[model samples]
Target: MIRHLVLFKLNEGVAKDDQRALAGAEAFAELGSLIPELREWECGWNTTERDIAYDYAINSLVEDRESLQAYLTHPAHQAAAGQWREFATWVIADIEV
Candidate 1:
């Protein structure tokens, strides 16, 4: 399986409580149901207040690299990611397990 992880940081001047941020979070939350290639999905806003902490995170699992690629290029996933691209920067990592 491939474990795909993402950490998102809101851009400067964007507040965590902003409606756009909430909408972005909501969009990601729906991805599990929207995409079929995903074997597992988990995402949420960060509750901790720390300087180095990202504002949001996504942890997902897929069968293999092909599935992971499908998940990444899926239209639904692209749309959700577009929402976040407006006000956040993110990093991702994929691990084989």
Candidate 2:
């Protein structure tokens, strides 16, 4: 299996309530049902206030590297990522389980 994780930090002055951010987040929230390759999907805003904490995170599971790649390349994922790219930057890790 593969664990795909992503941490997102909004650019300076960007807020979660911004319409664009909301739309991006909503798009991501719908991905679990939209993509067939994902075995699991969870995403949300951070609840803690630590300085090092990312603003948002996505944790998903896939059967393997190929499944993970399919999720990454899915058009809905691409469109949602593009929306977030307008206001945030992120880091990702894909770990084999």
Best by TM-score: 2
For model 2, residues 1-97, the per-residue Cα lDDT tens digits are 9999999999999988988889989999999999999999999999988889999999999998889889989999999999999999999998988
**TM-scores of all predicted structures:** 0.96, 0.97
lDDT tens digits, residue span 23-50, model 1: 8888899999988999999999889999
Poorest 10 consecutive residues by lDDT, candidate 2: 15-24
**Between which residue pairs do clashes occur in model 2?**
none
Worst 10 residues of 1 by lDDT: 16-25
lDDT of 1: 0.94
Q: Give model 1's TM-score versus the native structure.
A: 0.96
lDDT of each: 0.94, 0.94
